[model samples]
Target: MGIEAGVAGAVLGRVGASERVVACTAAARAAGVRRGQRRRDAQRLCPELVVAERDLDAEGRAFETVAAAVAELTPRVEVVRPGVCAIPARGAARFHGGEEALRITVQDAVVEAGYDCGVGIADGLFAAELAARNGGGGLIVPEEGSAEFLARFPLSVLAGAVPDWDSLADLLVRLGVGTLGEFAALPADDVAGRFGAPGVLAHRLARGREPRDVAPRAAPPDLTVVRAFDPPAARSDEVVFAAKALADTLHEGLAAEGLTCVRLGVEVEFADGGVSERLWRHEGLLSSQAVAERVRWQLSGWRPAFTGDGTEAEEAVWGGVTALLLVPDQVVPDTGVQRALWGRDGDGARGELPERVARAADRVQAMLGHGSLTRPHLTGGRGPGERVLRVPVGDMPLETRPEGPWPGALPAPAPSVVPPEPRPVAVRAADGSPVTVSARCVPSAPPAVVVMPDGSGHRVISWTGPWPAHERWWDPESSRRLARFQVLTPQGAHLLTLEQGSWLLEASYE
Candidate 1:
């Protein structure tokens, strides 16, 4: 009756059942079995159906997987629903030989991916869907027979699978329309007057008339170069070397074509069954230096968790980076356009900012390693602590800033320093005496601090009041309160706190 149920149906189909056992057809389609269905009716239909609640997130992920599998055939794949996708065939058909071959290829891919799917090809989306539905398992509606094929289908077919089919049938019979042919013969004006626009449209469709056309898919730029490894690479350094060579090859090709690539795609395959991909882009033509920097950035950013004498790490490197492909998602003409390099002008210098930044990031990555350099990002929360955070540098937008400066809050422009490992520090009372902390301690009194390993005590210079912070007050299972203070010591400025009344150093500016 509405888009909600259609979306819910697609979500349910993707989630399916989670018990690892096959569900009976009746049980699987029971009310409440799908999203937005009533729970009581679903239980009544199949008591032993092993009903599993729908997982929208998992369903969405699975839908993407299916769409990616389809992308192997054609780059233009539109996911209409969790279980349904639409692919324009004019170009794909020509590339694969013919329409039949394209259909077969799609069918084979779906089957191989462990999905039971139906594919339909026609001049329009509606006709293609009808072809798919009528084909049962898999169907192809030929260009010439599209009109003839749709004519025999009843008006009910266009209504989709709704619950009130009997009521609709009764209404049709009351109107003296029993067959699709009879309904088609009705005048569009009369149908519109009686049942509205949807009815008139239904009449037109039954008579084999559709007024839509296939939309053309957008084509990417024309520069592309690929390199396949003879044997898989395993080490990060080896992968970097290979990527460097591949970048050179791509640069040479682009130079010869008199074009420049603004975007790059990197794909990696692992020996122990793993795959990773990354996309990179530049605002202008990628120079040789820029290309090399991109390759290094990609390699440095990847880290795999495994234990060995560095042999496994080496083997896990891009030695297995068997294939490397660079595609120009965007391109610009190399016209000899130039501006005077005088008064208030340096267009060339202004244009080189992207390349300079990229090069700088690459150098830092080479020296410090990937995941070390990062940019601040705003997290999706209103709290002071959650307002801003940091993520891998290149992975997120660079200009992302904090929501606003919070008064009486932690200092702005957080430290660029990051410790390899946390160094434990001993805290002391004003009398140079170690204080013991306990959960039952009153907030009015200060708690003791002790350094790890050796119990050395440091004197507190100045201290602020215990600002108590309580969170998750409504949830008893997660409720917690902490008393914090900015305590200055001879050694450094530190933020000391009693978390749930247990003494710990929250942070330090040394």
Candidate 2:
């Protein structure tokens, strides 16, 4: 999309909530940009790298073309995400000549639709995804060859296969289990014992098995939740917002039966009798948030057909959404989630709250909206104030400490108090002259006294250097130059900054 918008260079990246390179183009890969690399680091590596925030709505709308094209070859095209999808190979291949022929036909179909795609067939979805990403515009893994095909790949390939797998991959590497084959060679029981449930799942993937073990059982009750908008909803946001509660109800119903679905069906009915439907797949169980997100994408992707004369066709035009339905498919046993041993959440925060407390917070948020409750998150910056960001509860923060090194960052033992606003004060030398720092970062005099805005004075017992910093020097508009000093007053220690000849208290050490 950025390329189509005339963004310079083919080196492009999709930045995620963490402001990291969630996905990048081939040119970006060639330029040493990889997934999870911070935005700044990626720009540094490829100076012309064009980055855009990940827009699921736009991606969903764009992918509708590919999905429609693929549906011509196969009826059921399970959309894994905006860019990836899967189809049952056996039946589709037989109807389209052969597996190889089907792959070519599918790829050509999408290409003819003004999009390029890779088609790969394997025993399981995981292996098929890997095969699709293989070189040579993707390749088909031969029957029962998934294990062998995956063996040569390093454990790092499992990084994004599931949540928290990166850390597990690192641990496996340190244990001399460098490749899929090595990790697969370990006994499943031992892997479970040593690494617990997540290890078992990873081992299954390594051994070319489906990520989830299907324990076949009788189909549960219909776990469909529907919402009818009185008078119909003309705006997409109205329906999208309602999807959250609908999804929540669906999940609650499924939870009551100890069941979950691998695939979800989102069907929307328009007042004009028009219908829009899509299938979303998740190897693991989808949360309520996940379901609602897919709903948003589906709505964003929907479009009415046009007449031959470039005018909106009356039959194709949708008046408004009259009803919305969520149908759970491929239901399976809910094996439950494994809690982190250290009680840490996805963002590396020890965020596990008591069940009651968590419920209370969720209820409060539901009543007051997303931003009513928030928590502080640590981020990358030099000053204590800049290092922390407040994020809404249940929201993931976009910044992290690994973004890049802060060359002039403050030393360890951060201040205990960081004021919301700058507190201007006077730092005077013994002779009553205001203490000033030169452009060379040299202080005119060392000993000084502090005068607060309230007209209170405190004697400075000791002090640290007038460390100077030049930040964002390349950008003339946002650049800042300042000198900092840690002064120990008789009352307490304070972090003071000298910028443009004015002194402000930034933080205070307890």
Candidate 3:
């Protein structure tokens, strides 16, 4: 699903406690991988599976245009989450002549915005959502038909719309309350008593009545900040870097005004004059980092543009990121904000050094292209060298998670310096023969001398290990099997690895 051939992929949670699979492509599911399975189990089910971390921020950014297009149909649209929003059907329907007409209007608007979307109309939010899920040109329930529409669906449909739906559904199905219709038939008092407010609320949805208020929120103030890109951005990294500074400035302005944002908006105007925007929400206050991340994520999801409706071979030559805008869509009192936790400056007290560093890095990137300069982060891996990755600064990683515990991983008193390239070295055993390591990780003999590639030799004074490491054993072509050792000499201790038939010095301890 990622930049690879079809028929492979998986995604898992980023938090260590929840490393279970979060998503999997159809190809992976067909191979027996599924969401909720552990990393090892998913891999065991399909060794070729590609694992990634969830990118909710990016998804939010991409959904902005669709949300804005929906807004054009009616001024009041409430975003429940990325990929879904709720609009008041009554006013829009009256304005457009009817519900069916409104549906077509929405579909057209979304398509024009360059996204395919589904529009669902019914009595309430839950039923409308179900209608959307029915797919195929979007679904429109007849006036007063939400009850009938919900009736046909199984109890499992309650999962997202209703809190604690799973446990209640399981218990209900056992008692023969299998369908939404049957659940709706239950006494409201009985449901409230048995399952509490959530159950009673689910009962309301089952009956086609809105369980919660669905009125459109008031339009947010136009605290939008837009920056024009002179040459437009071709690659994502530079735009993403610039996004960080913009988000920081925008949020700082909001903070000075004593406001905390609930729903935020991001808009990008492309070099070709094409435009896109989406609204994003946060449970608590969103930080500058989060804002920048969402913008970057949104940029990655954008597709390449073409011209002349498939007749012309030319692409939009003037296309790149021409401008970026950040807006605070819904704000709250700054009461919950804890300024002290953020240190001296509200935006992480970034200080001069980081700002200077960012400017220098950006300059270098502008010269060498986006990814030429990378900032290293310690992540998951099996060995010293594998433990970190260099990612373009201010850009988001696709995986977004560190993968490891890497059992038998080299313990750290990490080397003071790791050479950019490993240098080949020769080792001799006590008996004077060239040292070697067996497949079982047994050293040919105890180390006696270390010979540099330059022909300088030093007798070994102390040493440890033959710690073995292996990864992706299923893929023969790419699998790695190596044994590492730490050997000491008068100069200093070095981390060395043995593979194939030669030894290489990988790092040096201070």
Candidate 4:
């Protein structure tokens, strides 16, 4: 039952800024080596702990075999994480006769690939993860018993559910809610009022159901560029160089539009009616260097042989690659693209990095045959965020100023930080009850402690206005009545607004 047999006496740790254990053999954990502890601390805790750096590329490449194995067993396989995969239980169970049978089949397939494996089945992923961690070869919690089964577990068991879970778990335990059952018993409304969105989410999870609505993404516009290789490429280097040039040109166009491409498609069409195309995705903006690297990687993995002349590049290559196309599948605004304040000479003597970036963005716009990048600028509106307007850079010829004046708008000193999305927060009264604003713009009680969105307990040094703004009073769908307040903590002053019985951190004043 133990997974530690392979690395019985050896301990492996993933090293980052400072070595922190990500995975370690059972013997190491048993010896007190723990995750999140610094390398020095881990060594002190377990003298035999072995440290090594985590190579993400290596891990991902190795997991491809696991993906292939699972793919053969079922058409639907989703990588939950790099090392873990999830197969829809219903189809697999039906195909294998039953849930237990499906688990055995999967384990057998993975085992045949020379790896030890465990399987767990439960009502949801949360429970299933717990079931897997219990060290059973196959653990299944009947649907009817999922909630009851989870109730006995102490608050500490939810450590992996979210970041800062340990502290949050301990906080709940000290609040006299030591077990999942006790925590789940509290009303959802009360939990939300006392905590925030994360709290509400955990409450639902404890109840055995986690609702999720993943929206479908919109299609990306075509930003494809193609190059023809005449007389066919005689050498691999010739085709690879052409691919890099095409990729670089495509990316340069994107950069000009104050944008970056995340996924680029590289396609090759042979003269003999053969084609090869693959999309490459990156975690960050693909620079010219990055695009070139991808070109190299793709070339290294592909060997073009025109159907039957021969498998050798010289024989079956069929007049080499006739065409190389680079397509940007996904484009997003470059958030980090900023104007340089210093000179190009490294001392801000006199520089035009901003101009350079803008020209590149413009070239991208021309290449895409459309509008330039749109940036958000402020106009006039009741809400601080509502005032911001997204204006295409090419449209700067038009005036952006408001006609006259905003009568009820708050004076100068605009908020320094305004979150694109409001964050859930809790404002409490001096009596320890949750503070709220009424429909008539009245305080339920004097506000005291303010629980920031991060779950940190900050003491209210002093506070200001429940400035009420009622918008779209005509239509119920679009109408909203909010009372905005200014709260000051040691961190800084923040604007808190209450809408429909919920508090949100809208902006901050530095």
Against the true structure, whose TM-score is highest?
2
lDDT of 1 by residue, 1-510 (tens): 112221212222211111121121222442334333333444555464444445433343445556657877887665444456777799999999998889889978987876656678886666786676454445777676655777676554553322233345568888777766777777778877976645665666666566322345455345566666667665555665666677777777666766666556556655655555444444345555555555544443344434465443423453356666666554544553243322111221222324566678778988998777775554433223444466665564444333322233444433233343334455555455544443443433343444532456555666654555566679999996665566666766566555643566555665
User: lDDT: which candidate is best?
Assistant: 2
Model 3, position 266, has a per-residue lDDT of 80
Residue 421 error, candidate 4, Å: 42
Relative to the true structure, candidate 2 reaches a TM of 0.69
**TM-score: the better of candidates 1 and 3:** 3
- Cα lDDT of model 3 overall? 0.73
Off by over 4 Å in 1: 1-55, 160-170, 178-180, 208-510
Rank by lDDT, descending?
2, 3, 4, 1
- Reference-based lDDT, each prediction: 0.54, 0.78, 0.73, 0.65
RMSD of candidate 2 to the truth, in angstroms, is 6.9
Q: Which segments of model 4 are wrong by more than 4 Å?
A: 1-5, 8-19, 25-51, 154-157, 211-510
Per-residue lDDT of model 2, residues 460-483, tens digit only: 999997777899899999999988
lDDT digits (tens) for residues 60-132 of candidate 3: 6566667767877786776666667888789889999998899989989998987655688887777887686
TM-score to true structure, per model: 0.34, 0.69, 0.44, 0.43
